[model samples]
Target: MVRQELVARQLAEQITEHFFHGNGAAEARPLRVLDVGCGQATQVVRLARAGHLVTGLDPDPVTLGAAQGAIGAEPQQVQQRISLLTGEGGDCGRWFGPGTFDVVLCHGVLMYMPEAEPMLASLARVLAPGGMLSVVVRNGDALAMRPGCAGDWGGAIEAFGTDRYTNRLGLPTRADRLEPLTRTLSEIVVPLRRWYGVRVFTDQTPDHVGPPVDGRQLAQLLDAEERAGRTDPYRAVAALLHLVGTRPG
Candidate 1:
């Protein structure tokens, strides 16, 4: 809940800030959005509900089916706003023409790729001029923070020398440092516009655990997380990073 809610909030802010500044009416028209690797389509449905034309693509049919199921459960209006494709991010260009999307979301997907640059290049190629590229990646620079927080001194020590880690699900995954990814985005012609930290202090929460049921407590926790995510030094040490870029017009 924290991760998804924060992401949606930040995205709304950025979209309004960058695209709807003139008349204070940013929602004048629906934006063309693509969610690459939209697992279960949490963001896909959310964005569609916010009045955007959304296309969801996932390599796994099972995941696509899951996303379809979620979309089907929405009102007919929202259901009409989304389309699903079965494919991978690297194949984005192969499927869509250049400048096909106004907003492209590649969240929680890059960490699984062996090389982030090529995959980014592929996604960027489909972005229209002035299009937004939103990405979420594991914070390689702060890799030690998680293990250190858990009192695993040895694991923390091991994290410092590498950008690789085994995820909670026991799958080997990759992390990206801020500098390298920033450079890659520029190289791909989608220079980074903004970035925010995610799960800055709530990373230690076990996956099975749910957010506080108490409304006030949950709001306070989200407040702190949002503040820390946007603020300095704290964001630098966050568990995950959310980066937004724009292709030059």
Candidate 2:
């Protein structure tokens, strides 16, 4: 919840700043948005509800089905704005022409791949000029933070100097450091515009523990995390990195 909320807020801020002249009236203009690896369509549905035309593509049919079910439960108007497809990040080109989407999101999807450039290049090609490409991945530079926080000295030490790690689901995955990722984005012509740290303070929270039930506590927690995600030294060590890039117009 913390990670999702922070990512959504940051993305909204950037999208508004670039496209909506900063006022962020979602109804002002409906942009075409594409969400690759849109697991469960959290962002797809959110953007659709905001009046944007959204296409959610994922390789997993079961996940897409679940997302379809969630979208099905939305109001008729919102449901009308969303389209779900079966595809993967690299498969994006198979379904859309170049410069088709005003916004492209690939969140929590890169870690599954050993490298980032190939998948990133694929997503970038589908982004229209001046479009925003938002990416979220495990922070390779801070790979040790989680284990270190949990007192797993050996795991923490091993996590250093390498992006490969087993996720909470026990799935082997890799992470990305900002420097290399930024360089890759440059090579692909989607230059980095802004980036943020996600789950700065809440990364250590156990996955099973639900969000705070108290409204005030949840707000306070979110505020602290939001502040940390934007601040320097703190954001540098966040467990995840949210990188926003823009295609040259």
- Summing lDDT over every window of 10 consecutive residues in candidate 1, give the lowest-scoring window: 20-29
**Model 1 TM-score relative to the real fold:** 0.97
All candidates' lDDT scores? 0.92, 0.92
- Candidate with best TM-score: 2
- Model 1 per-residue lDDT tens digits across residues 81-108: 9999999999987899999999999999
Q: Point out where model 2 deviates above 4 Å.
A: none
My TM-score estimates for the predictions, one after another, are 0.97, 0.98
**Could you tell me the TM-score of candidate 2?**
0.98
Q: Please give the lDDT score at residue 124 for candidate 2.
A: 89
Q: What lDDT does model 1 reach? A: 0.92
lDDT, candidate 1, at 85:
95
